[model samples]
Target: MKSTSTLLAPEEEFPTALSELPVLEIHVLHSRVCRQLDHEYLTDPAGAHPVTLDRHHELVAELDDRDAA
Candidate 1:
């Protein structure tokens, strides 16, 4: 799949890390991860990838930090 970042100019490249993403981007990613987890839960209730869960936790922490600020 083509990333939207490809359309950006050289000066407008997307950040490579979750911590570097803007709040809006973080929210979008967080929501996408949640949907993936929900799908996994429906398909295999006994298994959800630890990496994905870790990412969700990271995004949540970033959001929480932003809110506290």
Candidate 2:
């Protein structure tokens, strides 16, 4: 049998320093629940944890906060 890895096309990279992140649009670190179940079943189980929809927002908050400090 052969394996197939073509699900989504490759994404373009935007290289930027950490200090240039944006402000947050939402608050609270999620409910800290069931987040893993959907990922475990829906995505590549062996692959690294998939980034959530709001990951960029969260990262922006983190980076922007560090810059402010």
Candidate 3:
């Protein structure tokens, strides 16, 4: 009879595909900031401009989620 130990050998854990994901672009981040600024300017020509770190974080989170999926 074949030994059960051979059948129970653990499989190797290969590197995740996400390890190959490319880094985010600085230019793209700048462009997104510029677009947000433009929209703010259009909406309120005299209002104090709000810098959106949250927007950047959301963008990064979305990219990471895509990579994981």
- What is the Cα-based lDDT of residue 57 in candidate 2? 47
The clash count for each model shown is 0, 0, 0
| TM-scores, each model vs. reference | 0.71, 0.28, 0.35
What digit string (tens of lDDT, one per residue) describes model 1 on residues 11-68?
Answer: 2232457667678777777666687677666777686667667766877888998899
lDDT of 3 by residue, 25-60 (tens): 433443454465555557776732433444444445
Candidate 2 ranges with C-alpha deviation above 4 Å: 1-10, 24-41, 49-68
Tell me the tens digit of each residue's lDDT in model 2 across 14-68: 2234344333312222212124324444776574344443344454566557668
For model 3, the local distance difference test gives 0.43
* Candidates ranked by lDDT: 1, 3, 2
Query: What is the C-alpha local distance difference test score of each model?
Result: 0.63, 0.36, 0.43
For model 1, state the Cα shift of residue 48 in Å. Answer: 1.3
Residue 22 shift from truth in candidate 1, angstroms: 1.0
Q: Any runs in candidate 1 off by more than 4 Å, and if so which? A: 1-16
lDDT of the structure predicted as candidate 1: 0.63
